[model samples]
Target: MALRTVLSDPMLRMLALAVLLAVIIPVGSQTRPAADLLVSAGVFVLFLLNGMRIARSEIRLGLRNWRFLLPLLLWVFGAMALAGMALSSLGQGLIPPLIAVGFLYLGSLPSTVQSATSYSALAGGNLGLSVISAALVNIAGIFVTVPVFFLLGGTGSEAQIGWESAERILLILLLPFVIGQIVQGWTRDFIARHGRHIIWIDRLVIALAVYVAFSGAVEQGIWQRVDASAWTWLGGMVAVFLLFGHLGSWVVAGALRLPRPDRISFLFAGTQKSTAVGVPLAAILFPPEIAGFLVVPLMLYHLTQLVVAAPVAGALRRAG
Candidate 1:
């Protein structure tokens, strides 16, 4: 049962895949270029699948819960960005500037859908609200992230902000998503029938993206520049940020007088960040040199959220 549970755990599987790829893939192999291209294609397909799977009715329902959704959005997009900037300024001496930018990038991202909804359902939360909230935030993030990126001083030729870059982003990310949504009705039944398998495909793409990102970083002497102490500091900072986010959500939920289940949905929705969106956006928006560093914080935050949310979800289930 333990072995089966381990095998079935998506978080564990993703972490294992990342570790394996990081260890096995050489720093500058001939396959690096191919892997990079594959990562881009995989990300496009991942988003396409997302567009197809998301229910429009759920998104509308989430939007209708403006009282809950508005505050959550403010915290995710505003407070987190402010916190990241402050941390970056304070930790400049301790960690690299690029890594700080990574934190800012992580902050600017939207909440995740799959795990947030799954955990909320497990915890007897308002699963429909969770679904709507996650989907709405991510969809809104498609437009909001670029402006937030510039606000955080992530601007330059290399940072790739401008009309051309915007067009490229639309073509690569948004266009396919729109196309998928348009065709979703035809695909919905098929998607429902093979939902579990499709999720694995998403995970596989994400793992491949991580592998490609880290491989590039390894070649650029990321390990040499970021020592053990720096990693420890980075890890500590991420833990604090996550804890504060979760706690803040709980406080806000209570202040809003949210029902227990809605509170659970709001807390999880506000606290979680989307790795699926973040990794791909980093690859598109940032230069290769900094992209790897940009995604490190995101990957760390993703893992930390999974670790923290699992037990919390279990506790919530028991309490309910």
Candidate 2:
């Protein structure tokens, strides 16, 4: 699963390189605070840019299209999250507790924008809705994922969202986003001028966060804990998740009597998990070592989605 994500996307390849760098030069405890500060700044900028670029009309479009959007909401956060919880419950003795918690984390995340959008386009899906769905969920995940994670018994006492964490989220994530929206009208040309380059900002932050998170895990002996059997278990469990994600989304959308393009949007939006949202947020929410353990399932699910999405999109195209 790890190798697959690394192989599938250039951005993910950079992320893989980040993991390698973490392994080689793990951030010591002394340096972690500085690293955390940098990551927080990057996340603030990333979401700020997101707010600037995403037009308000698009958000309203997603909201008014409730017939298609509501089921998508249910399948993504509701069904997928439940699946992760059930699996997490089942894997108690079968896997490490953190990795089991990782399932719920992975399930709780929003869809990746690039993959879901690209695959939706390839499959002759509704491009506008796909784009909007991806963006909305990515934005919404910041607000939704952690609460849902804790509600589902993601961890014990150490895992609750302390007031400190909530305040940080509001300050870093929410505040910047609101500020960006406020200034977007004035900064339209500035954003348009460098919009393409802004994605690098997002990628760099995710990479840095991934590096720091894994550095903590390396410090905690991640490699030693994840032995041969654990790898095997991880592979099988992730496959089960992949199947459930793609197949279940499709089946549920069809059962909802969605037309093909809308159904395709549902499939793509429901199936993919965003490292963009997941890693940076995890860095903020969990301690570095715990964040590292939690992202393992996410890393695998992320790249594997790239591997499977092309073929799935092609199949959908053919069926259409």
Candidate 3:
């Protein structure tokens, strides 16, 4: 199969990711920092575009589902905390907690709209619930992330919660989302007529963001702190985390007597973390050096889950 064809396969996104990393490995070391920052800044627009496409009503509806959500949130965070403890016992020390905390926040993060809806539809989840869940998570991100960060020791124990980054998220990500909602309502016919063209633009923006962020991370020599053994450990950790996330979600869904469809939604949506969201958030959360380390486990997890979950999701779809 051709390279693009292979990449389009969810199972192969990991291979594509490997290629992305390989390209970044050598050149990332030599790139200028300013260029990287500019690119990173530019990537935020994709978040905006995604936000634009989200319906405000979805967010409003999310409040009603807090009953279903609160328990799931607790389960994910609690499990991650336990996993962090396990990692620490295994000589990973503080790294595991850091990774676990990062992941717990990652778990708490807003769900992806398209993916959640698609998976929910395939797996027999409440379509409205999926939409509302995604919106709620994102809206909560604006209000809850900073406090959660402090609670989880992400921003340090004494770190004062501020509105600076949250404001940026609102401006950079939320503004375009609101505009998109307007566009959808006001010029629904026009957008429908040009929807295909707009989608391509959206994709282009996302690709540009990925390239720029990777390049910036490279230019910053972020990989210098990681060695071959660390890579090996990370690879193993990602695999385990992927396994744990999916299986744990499945078990929990079953234990709760959730229907098959809701189980599927819970299994995939709850377990899947978005690098698209995580990377930029990490940069905003930490200094370059700290962000680099903080993000590595998440980046690894993001890639692994995509690669593994794509096939799993597809299989679930086919079976259904």
lDDT of 1 by residue, 187-263 (tens): 99999999989988888887777766776676777889899989999999899889888898889899999999999
Name the weakest run of 10 consecutive residues (lDDT summed) in model 1. 1-10
RMSD of each: 2.6, 2.1, 4.9
RMSD of 2: 2.1
RMSD over all Cα atoms, model 1: 2.6
Q: What is the lDDT of residue 147 in candidate 2?
A: 83
CA error at residue 58 for candidate 3, angstroms: 3.4
Estimate the lDDT of model 2: 0.85
Off by over 4 Å in 1: 1-8, 27-33, 156-164
Ordered from best to worst TM-score, the candidate numbers read 2, 1, 3
User: Which pairs of residues collide in candidate 2?
Assistant: none
* Better candidate number, 1 or 3, judged by TM-score: 1
lDDT of candidate 2 over 1-320, digit per residue (tens)? 33454375678788889999999999998989999899899988888887888778788888888888778877888889998888777666777888888898888888888889988999999999899988888778878888888788875634456888888888888888888888889888998898778878888999999999999889989899888888888878888999999999999989989888989999999999889888988888878888988899899887777878887788889988
Question: Highest TM-score among the candidates is held by which one?
Answer: 2
* Overall lDDT per candidate, in order of appearance: 0.79, 0.85, 0.56
Better of 1 and 2 by TM-score: 2
